[model samples]
Target chain A: MGPLVPQEIIGADWNLFIAFAIGIGFGFVLEQAGFSSSRKLAGMFYGYDTVVLKVFFTGAITAMLGLLFFSLFGWIDLNLIYVNPTFLGSAIVGGVIMGAGFIIGGFCPGTSVCAAAIGKIDAMIFIGGIFLGIFFFAEGYPLLKDFYMSGSMGPLKVSDVFGISGGVLALIVIITAIVMFKLGELAEKRWPREEY
Target chain B: MKTKYMNPYLAGVLLGLVLLMAFFFSGRGLGASGAVKSVVVAAVDVVAPEHTANSGYYSKYVGEGKSPMKAWLVFEMIGVLVGGFLSGAFSGRLKWKVEHFPGITANRRLIFAGMGGILFGFGSQLGRGCTSGSALTGMASLSVAGFVSMMVIFGTAFALAFFLRKNWI
Candidate 1:
């Protein structure tokens, strides 16, 4: 009923096709959300614009809730879905590096690709940088192999860590997001700078 | 010129719905860096099959009876390009231009963009996914990795935002 490819509900060929369609939606929403602009994205940190926080948290919460509901309705098998494995040390280290890249480059891989499509030089550069970065990692894999594989916590969920239900966690996230949204709006007003 | 953006909450809802559909239909979330990895693997496989086969990092992706480019992420990335183009066109943002801060030259911006990209690329591999795959989709599943990655990414960016203030602010 769910996870078409993994469960053999859909053929391999259709998997990529579905991925393409999902990607279209992902790209469309990203652009519409003003994710195509580096200045707009960077504003999240400067307190000038909180669009990043608003959209990001909203999206995360929305999906979290959706998954919970889907599971309850038996519409999708949450267990069938892929969960990114946690390698604590690498996750933190990689995330930190990417954060620096985000602020400095002004785009993540997805946003960079979307921006590149709309003729953004910065985005294109970011994409190029991503390739170079991957290439560098490939070439120097030996040097970072140990750290990359360190801190294996297996695949675990935040809910599991807290010994709470997914629904409860989702509820908590929604409430936190609401509070943050209010604060974000306040920060924007307090800082109020020119739009990029 | 007026810059228009969709309502944040609405857009977020729409994005969430899309993510939900992804799970319902494919039992997976969205991704971006994986596509690039496919491209890298394919390119390396074509140019230096032996090298890719011998390498610990590249060999895992390149194998017999398979084309690296034929992965799910790659096709989705192609879709992302088309969808982004359509959205930009409809929104009147499909113009060809270099976006940068006034303080920096276009060349400087491009240079940093490339450098930043390189760092992001490397980081994504180490981190196991990029923003879309790791943070957004990961968080949706309530995966600890996802939350941790999200914190690292945003926290690091916030920490460094002051130093790079001129680049954006």
Candidate 2:
């Protein structure tokens, strides 16, 4: 009933069309959540605005719980879902570099696209930068082959790493998010900003 | 601002619902960088067919009756563009301007934006995903890579935010 594409519940071409629709939903939510602004995004780090934290955690947990329930109701087969594979060294290294980019550039790959759609010049440039970066990596693939393939730990779950069930882990994350949300409010109140 | 945006919590819930829909339907979460990678692959193929085939990275994405642009992520990205445009129109934020702090010049903002994009782009490829692909989607699936990527990205930003404080707050 679920994972319509993988299960052939939808045809190949139709799967792509569904992907487009899903993408629209994703982008619409991102912009509505004020994710199109670099300043608003960067503010999460400054304690000025923590909308990123609130929306991001809320979205993640919501989906996590949704999957749990969907599987429980026998609507979706959890095993068929695509899990992002773990490449330990690369994930940490790549994320650290991206973090630097987020603070300095103020827009990530996804957010910049939304911002660019609304005619944000900086976002346009950011998109260009992404192109250049990918090009550079592609050309330098020979040099990066080793590091990129290092720490290949195949699709492993965080819960598996921590010796817990997905439900238990999801609950733990929800609780942590609640605590963080409260702290985020305090931080924002303590240090308010006039800009959006 | 005469009007305000949606409530953060509500937006989060709606966003989560969207993510849930993605999983329920496609068995995959949202992504942005993968689409761009397809574009790059397609561009290289068009520019140098022989070179694309010869390259280690480019060849994998090109050839065998495949158009790099014909990927799920690519189509999804098109939807993202439309959705973003619609949302901006609805919110009256569809203006052409360079957004920057009063403290920084437009040129400075664009420069930093490009530089940051370059880093993010490279990292996404190396990390095999971006904020949406690796962090948000990964975390929801309870993947260890997702947690590690999320923590590292945010933690690194938190550590560097003070040094770059002049740019935002």
Candidate 3:
């Protein structure tokens, strides 16, 4: 009943338009939360600020719960919604590389774009670097293709792996986020410094 | 000294709603890296059409019926730029400056930012997504890829935090 594109409720042209609108909201929220600042984003690791953790986990949990309820009420068909397939080796390795990038670059792809929008010269350079990195990956694809597609575990869900329902997993995530929020607050207090 | 940020929880709810709307209307969740990939492909095609056609990876995104800029992610990314600009303007955070720590020079910070971006770009290709695409949106769909990406991205950052302490703290 939902996922208008896959269900053919919306045309491809409209899908592109919708992507733009969604991106606006996504960027607005990110900027409002101070995600445009590398210092603020990096603060998540140093305990000077926990806005990243708070916003990130809260957003994740809210989306998880929303999907669960939407499915329960038949507002949207969960099956039609795309689930990212897991490629275990690449996922872990890529994530690790991204992690290093996060600490070093102090911005992710989305946030970096946001930062650049606000006139951060560094953000612009970072974006340039992304292009170069991607170009490098493409040129070297033959050498890395095997590992890139390795450890295919299909599109398994976290709930499926844990032998639980999606709803239950959502609950666990919400609870866990709350606990982490508390710890984040404590950490900030213990390591208070000038605001980033 | 400045406008306070929206409550994190409220911001989260709003973000989630935005994400939900994305799935409902587009049949897919949010993404960021894909936009960059589109740009990369387009650049390669423009500069070296023959090379792009010859390469397996570049060819996939080029050739007949393909305008790399026509992708949904590209439009979305354009919107992100607009939205960010608007938000910054309204919040009075719109300023032309290089953001960095007092301990570091702007040049140094920018260099690191570039290096970091290169790493993230390469990593996103390998990982199949960046934070927004793989970690956040993936987690929303309950995909293991989402959780693993989230864990490793954050875990590695935390592990390397000490080494990069001079950059931030």
Enumerate clash totals for all models, in the order shown. 3, 0, 0
Q: For candidate 2, state the interface root-mean-square deviation in angstroms to 1 decimal.
A: 0.9
Better of 1 and 3 by lDDT: 3
Error of 3 at B165 (Å): 0.3
| Model 1 lDDT tens row, A19-55 | 8998899899999998998888888999888898999
Compared with the true structure, what per-residue lDDT tens digits does model 3 show for residues B60-113? 888889889899899999999999999999988888888999999999999999
- Least lDDT summed over 10 consecutive residues: which range in candidate 1 chain B? B1-10
Residue-level lDDT for A67 in candidate 3? 84
lDDT minimum window of 10 residues, candidate 3 chain B: B1-10
True contacts kept of 3: 0.88
lDDT to native, each model = 0.88, 0.90, 0.91
For candidate 3, the TM-score is 0.98
Best-to-worst ranking by lDDT: 3, 2, 1
Chain B TM-scores, listed for every candidate in order, come to: 0.96, 0.96, 0.97
- Residue pair clashes in candidate 2: none
DockQ of each: 0.83, 0.85, 0.87
State the displacement of the C-alpha of residue B50, model 2, in Å, after optimal TM-score superposition: 1.3
Native contact recovery (fnat) for each candidate is: 0.85, 0.87, 0.88
Write the number of the candidate with greater DockQ, choosing between 1 and 3.
3
